[model samples]
Target: MIRYVHMYLVAILLVAGISMSFPSGRHSKAEAANDMSVHAKAAILVDAKSGKILFGQNMDESLPVASMSKLMTQYLILEKIQKGDLKWDDVYHADATDQDLSTRPGLGNVPLYQGQSYTVRDLYNAMTLVSANAASRALGRMAGKSDKHFVQMMNDKAKQLGLKHSSFVNTSGLNNQDLAPYQVKGTASDGENKMSARDLALLAYHFIHSFPNEMDIEKKELDQFPVTDSYSIPLRNKNQLLPNGKYPYKGAIGLKTGMNDAAGYGIVALAKRGQRELIAVIIDAKNKKGKRSSKARYMQAQKLLDYGFTHWDYQKISPEKFLPTNQQKIPVENGTKEKAAITSKTTVTELVPKNSHSIKAKLTLMPKFLTDQKKRELPSTYQPYGLIEVGASRVIPSNDRKLTELTLSFRKLLFFMLISVIPHF
Candidate 1:
């Protein structure tokens, strides 16, 4: 039941990864509004439905992703929850080994008494909503063999997911040696995580698509964390877009946030409108420290989300016209009055705004279609070469006349022949 359908299909459609170039003036009035004036080291806007890179700037540039990397940590832990390996109510014992990097005065952390145990749900909530370093480290250690070994698991997972532009040095996104104790002492790695906006977006997109209900853990309140002793610590969601925040954007969901002198301010924000859920990765926002909290990141994320909603329209690319469609029913050989129907195999999403012209989805048909009937043969690779031009609402076919004619007539004879061409975004 480990399905790789989407990943496999995406690989086939893309000879390369997402295109990095930003859209030009030819786009619609709304799409052209993508003219962004923002501050960040790297940023990207992605359509979760189609895996389309709606917008990117310095997206491929690798840099410390800060606590944004914790989203991946949360992902690994959630995977265990989804399986039978871990449960929400399961309690873990916190000891000297669990003692975090610092007793920093105001740092987001839940104090633990020796020999006391806390539920996995409490640790998870603290990690997700408050961005607690100790919570994340504890979870990694508990989930994997050790904090050091778990860092290995993180990198291995990154390779398996095809995150080429990412590398993990620690489970918790801490750069200072004093902060992360999980890493072996005297190791070369300073314990900082690095990833490009595109790679981070891919990981977040996969997480959102795979675990729908489990992600609800983020919406919890700070006061919800259980208090073991007289120390009653309350921590609010660092993501300001969520409810009861300084600047609550409509439809904003609770996401992770990170900040440090080197990493600056960063966030991976998610929002949904009807069927579309947009993921915006804003990294390395300017930091005046307390004077400017994570507001700049939240504001930039809102802008990107606004652009995605205003600019694009989704349309399904089907091959009904490219392939011949019989009138209601096509008679089947050696069968009753029942006739078979012809349908296209390609059903994909393409993001093109309304009234946009000049965008084309060119399909390169294989050379076999151009030869004579006697000499005609499919590519030795055995892949379909039919082409589809994608646009706002049109799927323009580009193929040799002989191939078109043969397909139209032959399609009527075969009851269940599927159209070979796939409409990729």
Candidate 2:
């Protein structure tokens, strides 16, 4: 009987151990840091939904982005698509300038024969999936009359998106040549493209969120171009983490991969598991001392993803609870409703940093509302105001002594009743 009891105890202990292996909304940071020390000069993992940086190393430092500049190119092209200025079926003819920009030696190319016409969809696929420089230049030329104008659009969009540390020079990240003395306006760093890991993550987040349908283009492991002729230029996606049977990480979708001698190796990888999605960026990962190879960027990204998943979780907190309740609603007289709910624009999800228990949020209201001379300002003191109709007169309590005496008497009666009831319990 004792032997049977011991066996039962052992079985129970084993089951308990297995259950303990599964996490109950908790994570460990030290374990993640130890696992992520292998590669990557700079890496950042962010919560895609909240734009919260979960983990980072050298994230703010700007670095050459190489073919990753194509991400911005993709953004601009997609922006045109969204705005109805461009379409997937639009045919773009590759001019000599486009061919020259794309066909430079040592650059990824779709090998577009000069004067070859391809649809916007084809160029977009090549630009994003194959990291084709020629495809990027073609798309740029199609979007704006000149590559220079397209580059300007990229910078303008970056500024609008609040990417403070990012800039673009060429459509394809070709090294800028010294223009003649009359044309040189800025240093190479001034014109040459660069972005911090944080900004790159933001750009990737925008792409993933804005153009979710475009993700279908990134899934093709192999694609052949020039549908008319039997001559097919086969291309493989450089982003290895996409959901392709091989190297599948649950809900792993695409992003982009980039590499050049100057830029080293960069990748912006996105993954979704259920409602939680994450974006990881790695920049300048090439070890100059030959300590590590080009694959370091990918490995670093994977490590960051693993760390983020293991150590952090998206916790949704109420904005009203954290933010001051003063400006939660804005009174608008002319709108469909008397008052418009001006809740926080973003969901208040705390990307709980590793080993951290709580997070604090600070809220700021727009100054125009507070400083407007024409509008009646809401009271600074918190007053209980039941819902009121638009253009209705605000209830201002009369300063009569009789009302005040009556309110005090009611409060005393309620207090005595509460005190009287406590003894019976």
Candidate 3:
């Protein structure tokens, strides 16, 4: 009967899809530091949902980001659209600077002509899909009102995003030397947009969380920019790591890639397998000869992602064992029922080691949601009403030697007294 009870519980847990992993001992930090390696000067991987750093190597050192800097440009434009300050259909004419930059040979461009009008949607597609410098520049000007102000806006956004090691000098990630007179005034002539691997990962994290729709845009293998109603420029995605690209990786999604003489090769990559999404940043990846190797960036990023996926998983908190104190429901005031049933919001996922059996979490319910007594009913919505902060710590086993010894001694004394009083029974 006991065996059947245990089997039934296991079946229920399996049916509920609750993840159960057991601890596999622990290792010292020094011992664990050498467990993973990447072929890059600096690299980092983060859990996209929780923003947890899973791995790092020289990740804090700021380095040139090349075209990867366009991420800021893309983010600002999307933000404006989200705020209703800008529209995808809004049109901007190609300025002299944008037109000239577009035609500069050797730089990635779509030959945008001066006085030629392009919609925000077109320019944005060009920038993200093909790393077109002109599209990024025009969008920056439109968003910031000028080159200098746009650079300032980029830096300001970095700060607001809590980036620790990042600086933006231009909409395009081109070295200041390449921008010539078009560069932001008063800035160093050789300065280019720079960010640490960790900063880039964090920036990508916030960008993904804030505007998830952009990921769908990044998944396209090809798009067209209409230079004229009948004439369109074919835009090919430069991110070779896409699923359909040359070096496709499973679960690969939308992201940005960049390289330059000074910055070497780098990529801010995103991938999702199962319910786990990861953001990886590889900076200045190079070959053994110490030269920028375009292929090395993607390959190294793949290895970094592999390390994350292989070593970690999105451990979910099962509703059967959710908050220990509150059961699985919350009090609902002035509703048809005194309590509203609540389940784990879309499976409360916590990033943990592959062997982690469970996560220790604390759930903080907002008082405003619980104290509203005048409402006839709680409005139904798909969005989550509260957050459960998940965390983990080592569990130290308690030593009960002293208590055991005392109990044994008391038992022996009681046994001797009972024997003296009752004799042999």
Model 1 clash pairs are: 361-389, 361-390, 363-387, 365-385
**Top-down lDDT ranking:** 3, 1, 2
**What lDDT tens digits, residue by residue, belong to model 3 across residues 1-425?**
00000000010112121222111212223215436667687877777876656666676678899998888899899999999989999999876877788889989888787778899999999999999987888898888888889889999998887776899888989998888978889888998899988778878877888898778888888999988666897888998988778899988996999988878899999999998898889888976566678888988889878977887775554433433465344443333454444332233334556664533332333332111223322232222111211222211112211110100001111211112110000
**Candidate 1 lDDT, 56-148, residue by residue in tens:** 667766788878899889889988888879988888888875654424454556665556687888888888888887788888888885777
lDDT, candidate 3, residue 189? 96
Residue runs of model 3 more than 4 Å from their true location after superposition: 1-34, 288-290, 318-348, 358-425
RMSD of 3: 15.3
Error of 3 at 181 (Å): 1.2
TM-score of structure candidate 1: 0.72
lDDT of 2 by residue, 66-145 (tens): 88878899999998999999999999876666566555676687777666788998888888778887788788889986
Candidate 3 backbone collisions, by pair = 21-357
Residue 13 displacement (Å), model 1: 11
The global Cα lDDT (0 to 1) of model 3 is: 0.67
Error of 2 at 160 (Å): 0.7
Better of 1 and 2 by TM-score: 1
Give the Cα error of residue 396 in candidate 1, in Å. 19
In model 1, which regions exceed 4 Å deviation? 1-33, 100-102, 180-182, 221-223, 229-232, 287-293, 322-347, 357-425
